[model samples]
Target chain A: MDRFEYAEARLSSGESFLIREKGVNLYDGNEKTSFEGGEVVLTSHRLLWARPGDIPRGLTCLSLPLRYVVFVEEETGSTSFGFSRSKKIVLHLSQALPGKIPGPVNRSSHHYMKLSFKEGLNSNFVQIINETIQSKKWENFSPAATPSQASDVKLRAGIVGIERGIQEKQKAADESISRAFQDLSKLMGMAKDMVNLSKNISQKIRERQGDITEDETVRFKSYLLSLGIDDPVTRTDFRSENKYYIELARQLADILEEPITDVGGMMALTDVYCRVNRARGLELLSPEDLIQACHMLEKLNLPLRLRQFDSGVKVLQLHSHSDVNVVKNTALALEDQGSLTAEELAQMLGISVLLAKERLMTTEKYGKACRDESIEGLRFYPNQFLQRED
Target chain B: MAEVEWPWQYSFPPFFTIQVHNETRTKQIAAWRSLILDYHKITKHCILDTREAQRTALFNNTAIDRKLPLEGIVTILEDLARTGNAQPLDKQKHRWQIYWHTLEEWADLVYSWVQRCGMMNTVCTLYEITDGDNSADEEFHGLDTEIMVKILQTLEVSKKAELFDDNQGVKFF
Candidate 1:
């Protein structure tokens, strides 16, 4: 069957094509009236027409179920356009059907559609439409069963029961698969909650124990302590790797908060990673994962942030870290020592020499310290801020 | 007055690192400009060799254990040149003449030195104004010979003195 793009006809599932007649003129009234030119379509389940040319009317597109077709009729030279002859396909709807008309087409309405085909088109359309209507009627017929037919009905009934059983099993399997996906997400959320719970537990434990000896609550408490945390939860709780990393990042941030301040508010990222991993005990994180965790801290809006010097040295620092404070501290240290190298600064600040170098350079740039370059490397002394009495 | 002290930031290690951000770089460049000009003035030095400068205490901070690398020093000097505070002499930009005092300031100093020594309008050898016996009490005394010539050249440009290229002498107006 030829399909028209303008036709809004929907073929029901399993409905097959029958006939498509173009240039069929439709006239609801008698002959001598103008007609609308369009294509007429017929399918196993529906009959539809779409006006090819622009037509000024209430309904330019028509669709009705095949079941509503009452009969097909042929009229001689009686079309509204005074065509030589035309075939009228009359549809008697048993119930109201939705069409291009504004409201539902009335029930029991007789729709007279005339198709004027030249030569052999009318005959073919009439024959096909009649056969379709008859087949549809026969499909709904319930014949009185003879003895042989009764046995065939019982076999068909048994086959249908087995098909239904299979369908039920498939539906159950689909439901379980969907449920499993939902369960997985829920478990992920629970893992995150567990991290929080563990931290809370550790906090409570520390609060309650004035000075509990290492012998009591050794496994759980020691695990918490190993993570450099007083939280009740440890790294082993989360099943998913990503969730575990996120928890580690949070714990690392918390653990470093105090140490960073004590170490002059910043420390090399490698040093931080090593200390954090050591605190986490056997569950050591790779460098990439540690870097990712630090990045996650920024996204998580934690108080700690990562900074990379133009020299490509990466460090983790508190958001409140100020270069001024590091300069001040360096000046204080230099007050007594007069001048010290990176090694001495690292020792005084209790930070890595690399970190000390970074801070000292910043302090020097601030002009609070002056440097003395020698074969032994560089050392700084309090410049403008601290006066050295000879 | 006490010696001009460096602000605390000069000892910062990040200060040695090249600043990538524009705002910080601008501030760093300014800080470098002042430091270079001030140090050169105090030391009465003119040319700054990049390699030698990096090895000096001016670029190295021992207290913080940091030294501005050669490349970083070059960047700072280039910034100083851009601001007209220093002039790069070599095509490769390895050597720089730091303009601690502008040509006008040098002219003023030399012209005043001539007046103070009662040598105004006198044709004096370029070497005499720098190393001559009478030049001792003058501020331009013992100045770098090339710098003193350049200062006399400035005085010539302003029509305050005439240069006798044949004898390498200058006649002050």
Candidate 2:
């Protein structure tokens, strides 16, 4: 657009990065431009668009001053196919100012530009951009002219005015909280925004105070809750069972990969069920459906697999955690200790006694070790039977 | 009898339980068999009562407060019987005749002793062969009479000796 200018990617002293969206296409009015699938970054004073790797390398990029924008509105349209839809944010602009640096285009015919989101528009980005624009902290270019300082100037007139400001802010927070919880549908509609808001709050607090809480369990719980799946695969979404399970399996593998790695590459099926359901939130998956999806993981050549123990306890484990590796490791441990009980192995390996017992049993099953059962509990030793001479 | 020196496995608590694993159980049974034979050879005890074996030093490890249960004792005894180291005396298997040496082995020992003492072609009573001073230093000196008769009968089958008059006497020829 004519309003755009070519500038260095670095932010000015008083400006701060607000939000960024990838896979955005810059549209000049109704016509498309060569700037397709680039990253759009919003700052306190400007919106910058750069090719994927340009900004990181400090290359020249297109920057539009926020002062030139009159208003913004969302535009949704059905493509010609009628099956797929596209979303865009249209920014209306005023007349171009004088003395602007030349950009990708020297002149443009339109007074508006559109950012077509290749991925669906993230509502949180729109909300943040609106707030940044309304704050008008750009009006004063001084480095000390923060929104908090500006608000302090207004409320510092007297003690009563400061008290009234604090009361108004608290009342606004209370109103939003009550409004969000007024109905299930309303809460559901705002769940994504609320989660993003909470995450931002926690991030800021952690940056200032090191951590949000001292309790490890609560911290872990919050961490788990934050790993939410944006779009969970539902059975009703697909016509075929095979397709549904395949998609679900793919999604599950993606979500569980990090967690499984964190907890030693193996997790009980029951535990996995809980974690997946927790991440799914209102989209609760049945145990049967989860097992069905897991069965497809291996067929799909995923890195995860389902294994059942001799005692009928099922678990999900990384393919790297094969039985051969477990048995070999157990054999090595048995040789080192001469003999070991499940409890002792559990202590040594820092795993649950049940999993340790399972490992020992697996070794025994593979003929890598033998067990001694007694009142003290089952113990395993490196198999000397086959190797010993009569 | 001097105190029998037990093997290290005797002190292991899990040695009391009959292992569930097949390979482990086989090894465990072999250990038990050797222990039983060695104990009998040292203490010169010939019989094993299944009900009372649990209380004995052979089956019970008092130091560890562990004892071979009846089922485990039976399993080991059955294994020993299968290997010709022991024989059940009753249909219920509650009573067992433990032979530190097989009947054929015992026959060989007795025949060698008879030849060494120049008792060949000479008749000797079964009691004298077991309790007489001539065999005092022999490993089979306190052999049970029933087992002695069985050993002599084994010799008779080989024509090295003969049992006569209700197995009370044996002639070596």
Candidate 3:
């Protein structure tokens, strides 16, 4: 506990939040401490613990710098009945340095601490913490160094110095970019890390500003790209065809539900193929496999379904968009207006004219509406034959 | 006589286009049939020429800039002929003899008129029955001679009238 200093419950410059776990109890070596049911936040530079809501409220909290952590390991124990008890993470600590800030304990008998997770431990949390510690990010933040260091001081003055500095920065950026792309294998090796780095950079920018870009298309693209499917299901992952397709279908539903809704409840199968492949990154999904998975969507009772139009154009549509509902809505629109053309309906519904025509054709097929073909174009009207006696 | 009152559908643009849908086309043809009969009956028109019909007000709506295509006109006229409301005058079907009333109905109307006038056994020239002063107020006034001959032939077959040579006149029995 003496290793923990009373620090403000906020991140310092160059520090970023990594992971957080709730219902954690701090242990002073083998003995339990007063800190129970507190939240533990693991940042790039420190691990902070506070009462449930203290960190969010920006109150003072206990902080332990990553520099003090020698290593960490999981302490697992099973009861006599073979039931696992609460999991814990043991952090081996070095000696408290001299002139350190005051803490809950003046001196400690133990040189290590344990964090007990009342809820089961998340393997991901431990993995991320180990990665953060290995990165040694805390070593880069020297407390004694000022923001404007002597190394950054300009030995030369005037526009020449500014130009030289800009050139140097550009040269460094060029060298790093070239090095990253020097070999295909090297780039492949770093692709996962690059993706994580890019995500972190964007998150940091978003934290400082409202968005990374003002252009809506770029923002939307980033949003779609951000919805990545980690560890996409592949055929090799399962031995049986049925199991493979079912798993693939579930993953597709999870990734595509929001995007399909945004696109007005329907998307062409080709467009879906493109989006799924992009989200899966290098694991390109074949068209046949996509169709097979889509077929299983309904068998699994998912929220989406595969539909083929009369023209043989296949699309993925939400279950809520049944033909009966579409026909009913189209008939209402036709009745509201005396009549409608495909172009006019497209304008009213904010959809493509081709889709509007398809909708009208569906309504006509159901006998809810009729069409008039003329030089002006084909128009649709509510079916009056069923309505009128004459 | 007052001008003919057109149906509301006459002004609708799509009415000029033959609908592709079966139900819609059925109703469209029915409407066209009635409109044609009413228009011809009011105007006392006995013959319809397919080539000349395009310019007529019945087939063309200048107000809406919509004209029934030649094929659409033929389709409606064929539908009428199928139901005994019209007869193609030529093998090419270019000219049609429109009967607002069927020949049997016309025969009945002429026979009743003769009986009401106490001319049951009198010889009546075709023109006198169609254009003479005595029949001026009649529904068949100034009827086309060709159609009048057909109507008289129907009456002759029923023994209600006897037609003279060359269809010049007829004698009521």
Candidate 4:
């Protein structure tokens, strides 16, 4: 089955999307026992009843094809069993099985399949079933014609008007094409002599665009004349460009997630900025924009959060990250060497020395570690707790 | 000469580093206080110059190749002073006289020594108590003169000894 979308009433592939209503109901078929509060799905293909995430085989629920559905009728009398008004869908099948049986089978014995729904829901449901039975394909089922079609027609007319305007513009473009061909033919005949003149015109155009001095424009135009992109992205492509930027952000988030885990669930924001921009190739983002995107991730409730260290080094970390693990790791590392330098811890933790120092400081705050500041630079050791060595 | 065995942590590199965190630093200060007192007792030395201690093996462990910088030693000494176990001997506060034994303890020792030597009523010069040949067998022999004066002053304050200015000494009664 195709992946199920949570709470979506739609069906999977090979199943029909034509769901009239879906809610808790009873399926009392050939068996006297009733399945209580089971999710009843009425589709064009089958009457599928499941237990939320479970599509049980034989015991709880079953899928009865619509072809076997003999009739569907609403029993409007409110029963003491506390249905809003139970409606039963009856199916005459070629086979009787105690449990759910998938696929086509030859008839051994005939049996009836009955399912019920709550009140007021059976009217449109019966109509939908009738439509499904009469129609050749499930796609043909539609409710009564609506005014939306009329609006659709008006929209088509508006598009036609716009097409006419485009055609008028196309006519002007065709005229320009012909005039450009005439100039091209003249240039072909006088190509050798007009080269300098064409170059001068290009230079003048470059000058009109501004910022290019005469000499540099003459030099730069020569380079542009040799090569140019067909359709470089611009302001007109903002919608598509925005989509690409969002994709880049997602890619950056994915790339950083693993490295962040490898480095004990935190990474320097500036280091990530350089990495993300480099990964984007030509589409680099400014540092401020990268920070904004990180903020956006926090708002989106992604498994990432931004934090600033005491040394002012901003870091991105997993949402579940805590200092408890760092303290534990410090004690563990101390068990191996009894003492640790900031550089050594940096190597072991896959982080910078500055970050390692930060972790050590936090560890010391809890008395898990103590530091020695000597001529060899600062180092940390497991303190009273780890020293006990139980 | 029997070699004095230092604690295992003395050779540990971080032992020389100044602790920055309060909890760890508290433990570190306590450890240093004991070490300083033990070091003075073992070496029979009293004065601790911060600059000199940086090179001393007790403060800087050469075997582990870790040296406590002068600043760190000064910090530890300042903490010692705050705890009343050491007193700064100079205006610059760089020189400190470690009180492995408090002045009162030294005064008691001296009073008992005078009684044992049958000099209870005799006037003894301050130099005789510190550097004199008679005090050679005593634990306070070659004691810091300033510390000796402080000890004598304690004894005088308690009426155990009387100061005699003419002889620049104290007479025990």
Candidate 5:
């Protein structure tokens, strides 16, 4: 009755078919022209020949069983289905998965079958297609449970399908990434061991053993980084000019911010150098860079500073009174806003206990700040000095 | 001697110490020496020298009764000798003139007092100022001989007055 059913009964596994279709056709190489009953049919399980044909409205499942084809030719235009009969599975790229519409492909032999790609196909391109397929729920089949096993790892593809020559390059790229990750994994493992090692070193130091090595401090610092200990030092590549100085100042502010009030708001320059360098990803900073940064911060007049007290203890002191912005903010925060404990403020600022303490101490010394004590630790109140006694 | 509180001058610490700092020391010593002259003349007092004064009761830190140490007193005087308010009467004696009021100031005060008492046109002996009934009668009371002579010498030089030896004693006219 129709042009399709006439060829359907006559079609067999050996029969050739013609599909006049124009679009991207995934190929795995082998292609051949076959003559049957005065019809020109191209048999290409591997190669896809795009010819002018009806537009593909939906996906068609064209699966040749695993017993059919012989040698597969993995050429550029190959359709990924060269050795159809091989135990190897053929991945199809047709209309997106989960589209309900049937395939638009028709053989010149007039035989047609709704086409479908292999189940559980998960190439990145297939994913876009499958997401559409699953979203549409195209074919009626039991939903497969778990599809992606490697969602955690993500790396960008180096090259799109340039040709067969470049396809091996993609393979090379994958191998390189795997190698890099293996190296990274080894480093991460060593860092983990050091985390445990540093604890022992701390114990040994307490026991008054021979002093830890000069490098051990750096090693201990490395161990701390591994343990997720965030130090406040930041280092930049040494720059030749003044903007470098500005950058150093900005970075120094961020780094010295928490350490300012650590030792009663004062510390020796040497002690700060050791501690700051230790915390700062173990980066070596020249004294010149540090001094330059300090001078810049002095210029900025930040609440924080490099100060030498009368006792000759050089330390970073955060001046709460000097922090006009912080005082203004805390004033607002404590206005109708209630008093906050150190922990509470740390939580609010998403900072560590050290930073919270420094900020609070600075605020208190500014004299507009006071304290509230409870079962909880000390918290600062707004300068009650601002208000007239009722 | 009984300690006295001053109306305008108070004992501040650096008032005694030799300020090692240049500009500030000069200013500090000046102030202390001036304060010393004023305080001493008003109290009409004497201070022990530094080395010996250390043993005397001073600067007790008693939470009351402010006092100055002998070293502090010496330093204050040294500052004065350096400046010219008072001299080391004898460096060995460590004695000093307490010029709370300068000679000019004292001359003016004495002249005013004598004129008030209507003694201006009259001659008076140095002894009259210390011992005589009328002289001992007022606040312009005691006059040490040396200081009296110095004052008269100062006055005579200016031709404002004259000094003479009389049967009564050395007199100022």
Candidate 6:
């Protein structure tokens, strides 16, 4: 029979099922009852069945599985099983037996029994449970009155409790994961609403129209901060100052220092400026400061610079230009005959004015181009000297 | 407008500030130069009236409600001048002699270019400096008539060329 063919079949005292073949007959256990034929039944965590041929009246069947069944050959077995008073149960098959099995509540003397079968074994494991009825109460496993009955009962209760505890823990973890997923759905909805509000806000800022509310500004800033994306937006996270953060997370901490909807989250530079200073808020970080920071963090991230507008306009310089030496060098060459304006650079690099300026600064730092003050506006000339002179 | 892909959208304070770092400033100037050049290059026009470039939104686009003030334009012009690439035409006219090439560099390149064009011994007119059926060096693009005269005058003293004035403005003879 397939090992678990009778998994659903109940294993009662009277029930029996056909075994395709008897692989082994193990009748050595702590119990004194002995058996030799092929057929058997496991009524509970332990198996049991009527001994074939021998009549012990209502003596019921015999069996054992789950627990490690030591094959006690005689007084001499594996050296490790040495006990002056106790008989030896050779541990060879014991060693081959699977890991810890829930020990049964029992006792007995000399008759050798095999506690060999294991749980969840798809093979001969079901000779009893699959082919016969099972008593949920583990009837056949009841302890025969023994001198040490109290100690055995205590051990049994402890073992069962441990299994119960494990099941409860697993259930709790599964519940938390499911709840977190539900919260994730809610977070997505909030993000959409935030984006809409940001668009409206950005529009207002461009128009120089209306008084923005404190709450509104903070909300928008908080949203931008939320995009800190633990994955480094700029390579700055790997620099000396940020090594710690990089180890724990792939993101930069500065990115997460969002505009505080609260005073604390608000920095002397950001949250407060958005709430109080307004337009001239860029004063919080002047070009010198920005450039200094960029220079400081240059090795940290490749593309970093102090940017300028093509119209020679001074826009805020906040973005990172971690790496662009090659681009900057090319910009220098292009500056040869006709100089490129901020607009042209922006067009060429496919970056915003802010980004173009930042990159241009990186180029400047390398002496790529020089600035021109003409009616047309600040323009970049390929640093002819750097290239030609070099 | 040469679309400057701003690495970032500058929305905060000083979107009005044009940084002075040469490389960055130069790029900024070049971008403006392109815009100015394209404006004139496409319009085949001369003289960017401050009013038009600033007020008309034809040239000066107040992308963020903030128009490039005359100062902003002047600031860019100043940077270009500092880089020896361009100069101003005037206040209201806000015209720039965009040195797609620097005057000094242009002067030197012009001499060499003239030599290359087989005009080293020959005297070319002022108009010939920029406007002509010639593949001139870029340093001469939008070369101001007056500034060319000045450059040529210096060369004249150096015995590089001789000049003559005519109704067609000035001529290098």
| Winning model by TM-score | 2
- State in Å the error of residue A122, model 6: 99
| Candidate 1 lDDT by residue in tens digits, B18-86 | 554454566666777788788777777888998688777788878877777788898888777776677
Task: Give model 5's TM-score versus the native structure.
Answer: 0.39
In Å, what is the interface RMSD of model 6? 9.4
lDDT of 5 by residue, A200-241 (tens): 666675565457676766676566556443423334444465
Model 5 regions more than 4 Å off: A1-248, A261-268, A298-303, A307-314, A319-390, B1-43, B46-85, B90-93, B112-124, B164-173
Rank order by DockQ, top first? 4, 3, 2, 6, 1, 5
Best by lDDT: 3
Give the Cα error of residue A269 in candidate 6, in Å. Answer: 16
Which is better, 1 or 6, measured by DockQ? 6
Judge candidate 1 at residue A64 and give its lDDT.
52
What range of 10 consecutive residues in model 5 chain B has the weakest lDDT sum? B7-16
For candidate 4, list the clashing residue pairs, or say none.
A58-A100, A372-B17, A373-B17, A373-B18
Candidate 4 lDDT over residue span A281-371, tens digit each: 3334677766766766765667777788777878888888888887787778877887888899899867888788888877888788877
Which of the two, 3 or 6, has more lDDT?
3
Off by over 4 Å in 3: A1-227, A238-244, A366-368, A382-390
In DockQ terms, which candidate is top?
4
TM-score of each: 0.38, 0.57, 0.56, 0.50, 0.39, 0.26
Candidates sorted by lDDT, best first: 3, 2, 1, 4, 5, 6
For model 3, residues A176-287, the per-residue Cα lDDT tens digits are 8887667756765677676667667666765656544567546754674675664678788899989999999999889889988886788778888999999887556899
Per-residue lDDT of model 4, residues B135-162, tens digit only: 8999899887778888888888999988
TM-score of chain B of each: 0.83, 0.95, 0.96, 0.85, 0.64, 0.57
Better of 3 and 4 by lDDT: 3
Best to worst by TM-score, what's the order?
Answer: 2, 3, 4, 5, 1, 6
